[model samples]
Target: MCSLLLVYISVYFCILLFIEFLLPFPSQNRRHNQQINQKSSNFFFVFQISFMPKKMKSRYILLTLSIVIAIIAILASQTLFSTPPRVFIHNPFDILYGIKAISYSAITSVCSHHHHHHHRRKPSHSKKKISICGDFPKNIPPPDTDTTSYLCVDKNGCCNFTTVQSAVDAIGNFSERRNVIWINSGMYYEKVAIPKTKPNITLQGQGFETTSIAWNDTAYSANGTFYCASVQVFGSQFLAKNISFMNVAPIPKPGDVGAQAVAIRI
Candidate 1:
């Protein structure tokens, strides 16, 4: 509403400027300075008003009011509809723990490098040190014998399918049997969908931190909000555990059209 008002006001002032400065005016009397109407061939009438001292005060007042209103509208719109900043409060203990761990790692690395001068130190230790800061789970659990009709998906090609979408597509549609899909720990960057025809399906992941599915489709790009999800599930009796769905698209500002990006739609 405020935006429309601003645009209307802007266009009005532009027209006012054109009429005041751009239009030609032929003075009938120098002293009288009368207002006159000029008609063009297209039957369009233009009004020419003499610049009097009394009208100058009103014009100034109108200009000042328009400027003030525009500023107020801008500020009000920002205050009402602007997105709030995301705030993260970290635990002080976690900070101290991280600092201590880094310090210990540096000291141990220096000592190990100095003592093992004759021997060539392997680069594996550096990788291990890097893993200390990583929070994702590394271990992939073995599947239980509860569900015989099961498929496995792993990004490392150690399973039945390398992609989650492929595993879902391979499932028998409209199955009465409960099918389980075990996703190994790794990030899968793809959009997944389970149609209504495929029911009684359960998706199991190693852990939420390690097993994450991500896509970057927005509503505008996908044509609608219904099609923009990273994962869309329409199957009955569907279940997902230890899995994270993520839409890695950038955050849209207020007033952005078709900017809705969904993580999961069931």
Candidate 2:
């Protein structure tokens, strides 16, 4: 029995060895395909390291680097040189305001004015636009000719209103033009303001005697206080002659109630 068992075991061992070496029907083909795939993969790997970079690879790398740098630079600029976006406006009126402010400041810097220099004469060739203010001596006649006629007010006859300020309001409403308003002899008792719309307006008085626009108002005072000026002229090309502004305040102290009285503002 022992001899028989030993022979059987040897046969079993031989069978197992044969099965281990034997490939399955499909697995036989798979082995050959796997060899080919391995060979191909190795070849491509070598080729990539050797001759695969024949097409502009260096230039491509450089371009990619430059793009990355540009992105970084843009990000850096956001932190380093960031500024508020400018506001753009297309209004025609605003254009005039911005440019005129800068231009006038530049011009006025070169020309200084003082009290003694108030009575400067106009050019010889230029035409005279005369306006009379205050109460004339009742002897001078108002000019009828058109040359000096347009800019003068109350030139036709004596002022009908109780005060010259009433006449100013009437003129401002009657016409928006800058024609002169000549004030004939009168002690005007009121506060007035020549609006900015009335450009090129001029005021002439009868040597500040009969013709006078006097109001008692001040800066610190309330809106309608005597501290405010009797008349405030804002329009440009403003010319005043023989006009004397007086404070009608009963007090005479420095900061008196009538401390503010602007006779004429050009």
Steric overlap count per candidate = 0, 30
**Of the candidates shown, which would achieve the greatest TM-score relative to the real structure?**
1
Off by over 4 Å in 2: 1-157, 160-162, 171-178, 223-227, 252-266
Which residue pairs collide, candidate 1? none
C-alpha lDDT score of every prediction, in listed order:
0.72, 0.52
> Candidate 2 on 1-266: residue-level lDDT in tens?
22233345545555554564363435555665466556567576444434323232343444455455445335424423322222114442452454465457656754545423653643465776665544345533354354333323353354444455555565543344445566665566666677766665667776777677676555545355432666677766667778777766545567455344444444
Q: Give per-residue lDDT, candidate 2, residue 118.
A: 50
Q: Quick one: best lDDT, which candidate? A: 1
- Candidate 2 has its poorest 10 consecutive residues by lDDT at 79-88
Models 1 onward score TM values of 0.46, 0.36
lDDT of 1 by residue, 29-137 (tens): 3233332222223343222223333444455556667677576446535633332221112542343454455567778989988879846654555454544315533
